[model samples]
Target: MLKIQNLHKSYSTPQGPLPVLQGIDLNVARGSSLALMGESGSGKSTLLHLIAGLDQADSGSIQVAGQDLGQLSESQLAGWRRSGIGLIFQQFNLISSLSVADNLAFQARLAGRHDRHWQAELTQRLGLTQLLERYPEQLSGGQQQRVALGRALAARPALVLADEPTGSLDEASSNEVLQLLLELLDEQATTLLMVTHSPRVAARLQRRVTLSNGRLAPADGL
Candidate 1:
């Protein structure tokens, strides 16, 4: 469902061009999950951003669900991102002004795929029924993360891209949230590409790849 080839990216620093990703190639099948592992500054997050079309690569190609992302115009990319991809980040990124219910339904509504029944089910599954009226500042980190997960999945997008999703949670909370995420993804048959540093967390996915020095390799030795 996702493919990347010879991907290269760099950033302009005061000194020179700082390379982030170097000739990276990857393929993830439909309905499968892949974990991306790496150390700090290893380009894991950069790769995810490139795949999500939030940033452009200096070279190479990214194709998702048969559409070449490089070919899409800015407006088209925005529309595709709204309807075809669900993204969860390390930070909650919830709208502090909106209530939990509104945050959860925000993406789905934007995608024009809002389903009252489905959202209601997500609320219950995420243990958010009672917190619907609460705002982000009023919720705990774990609770806020759950709300973010609910928002991402409420739209039932074809692909889910998560970057350090459990980074801010404790071990127990992380395990709980990861399990729930996998269960929900399975039910929806959505493909997953998650960037995480924890081996324990990566082990839960169908496959794992490690990024080192901006290159991809099997996670076995990682």
Candidate 2:
């Protein structure tokens, strides 16, 4: 569902251009999950941003469902993102004033594909039915992250990009969150590309690839 070919991105600095992603070639299959592992400053998040249309690559192509991201105008990209991509960051990013129910329904409403039935099911499956009336600040980190996932998936986006999704939780919470994510992704046949530093986290995905020096490489067993 997603493809990247020789993609390159760099940032301007006092010391000249700081190359981040160099020749990043990757392809993610439909209904599959991939773990992107790398050390700090390895450009994993940069690659995800490019694919999500939040940032443009300096060179090469990032194609999602046959559409080249680089070619889209900012307005077009905004629409594209609303329709096709679901993003979950390390931070919950939930609206502080919105209750869980509103937070979960936010994305679907924006995409104009709000389905009460689907959102209901997601809330139940994510074990968030009771918390619908609560706010983000009232929940634990894992609970908040589950709410974030619910918000993202509520739109039924074809692809999900998660950057260090479980980075803020404890081990048990991380495992629970990851398990729920896999189960939901399987049920919906959604594609996932998550950036994480934990081997335990990466090992659960269908495949893992390590990013190094702005390039992709097959990672040996964790």
Candidate 3:
């Protein structure tokens, strides 16, 4: 559902342009799960941003679900993002003022595709039913993450881009969240590309790709 060709992204440093991604090529088929593994500053998150159209690449092309992201205007990209891509961030990114239920349905409502039945199912599956009335600060880290996941999947997005989804949780919480994430994706047939530092998490995916110096390595056994 996603393809990147010779993608290059660089930042202008005081000295010169510092490259974060160099000639990166990747393809993720529909309804597949893939893990991107890399160390700190390895551009894993940057790659995710590029794929999600949150940031523009300096060169090359990104095609997601048959749409060339490079060809879309900013307004078009924003609309596509709301309708096409589901994003989960390490920070949870929940609005403090919004209740859990509101936050969960926020994006789906914005996309004008809110499905009450789907949202109800997601709430129960993600263990968020009881906390729907609570705000983000009222829940624990794991609970907040569950709400975030529920929000992302509420609209039945074609692709999900998660960056360090479990990085902020404890061991037990991480395991629980990861399992739920996989089960939810499987049940919905959602395509996922996750950037994670955990080998155990990466191993659960259909494929594991490592990034070193902004280039992708072959999918090897974790």
Candidate 4:
């Protein structure tokens, strides 16, 4: 559902122009899951940002669900992202003042595709039924993460972009959350592109790709 061709991104550091992503070429099939694995500062998050339209690439073409992101204006991109992409960040990024229910429905409402039944089911499945009226601070880390996951998936987006989703959790909680996410994705048939540093997490995905020195490293089996 997503394709990147000759992608390049760089920044002007004191040392000179430093490349964060160099000629990254990737293709993610529809309804499939891909794990983006790399070290610190290896451009995993940068690439995700570009894919989500949060940041523009210095060069190259990015196509998600047959739409070329490079061609969209800023406002167009914003609308496209809101309607087409579900983003899950390492930090929950929940609104401090909003209740869990409101947070879950925020993006779906913004996209004008909020489905009451589906949202209720999501809340129930994420174990958030009774906690709907609570604020972010009132929930545990795992619960907050589940709420974040719900918020992202509530829109039924074509593509899901997750960056270090389990980065802040302990091993047990991370494993639980990852398994839950995978199961949810399978049930929803959602296409996922997740950036994670853990080998176990990557192994759970259908395919894995790593970034090295601003470029895609050779796939383990390909």
Look at candidate 1 and tell me the lDDT of residue 42: 93
Query: Candidate 1's error at 186, in angstroms?
Result: 0.4
Candidate 4 TM-score, C-alpha based: 0.97
Candidate 1 on 79-183: residue-level lDDT in tens? Answer: 999999999999989999999999999999999999999999999999999999999999988999999999999999999999999999999999889999999
Predicted candidate 3 versus true structure: per-residue lDDT over 1-222, tens digit per residue: 888999999999999999999999998899999999988999999999999888999999999888999999999999999999899988999999999999999999999999999999999999888888999999999999999999999999999999999999999999999999989998889999999999888888999999999899965953
Candidate 4: which pairs clash?
Answer: none
- Which residue pairs in candidate 1 collide? none
Cα lDDT tens digits, model 2, 1-222, are 998899989999999999998898899999999999999999999888889999888899999999998888999999988889899999989999999999999999999999999999999989999999999999999999999999999998899999999999999999999999998889889999999999999999999999998788988752
Question: Any idea what lDDT model 2 has?
Answer: 0.93
Worst 10 residues of 4 by lDDT: 213-222
Q: Rate the local accuracy (lDDT) of all candidates.
A: 0.95, 0.93, 0.93, 0.92
Off by over 4 Å in 2: none
Model 4, 1-222: lDDT tens digits are: 899999999989999999999999999998899999889999999999999999988999999989999999999998998899999989999999999999999999999999999999999888899999999999999999999999999999989999989989988889888888888888888999999988888888999988999998744774
Report the Cα RMSD per candidate. Answer: 1.1, 1.2, 1.1, 1.0
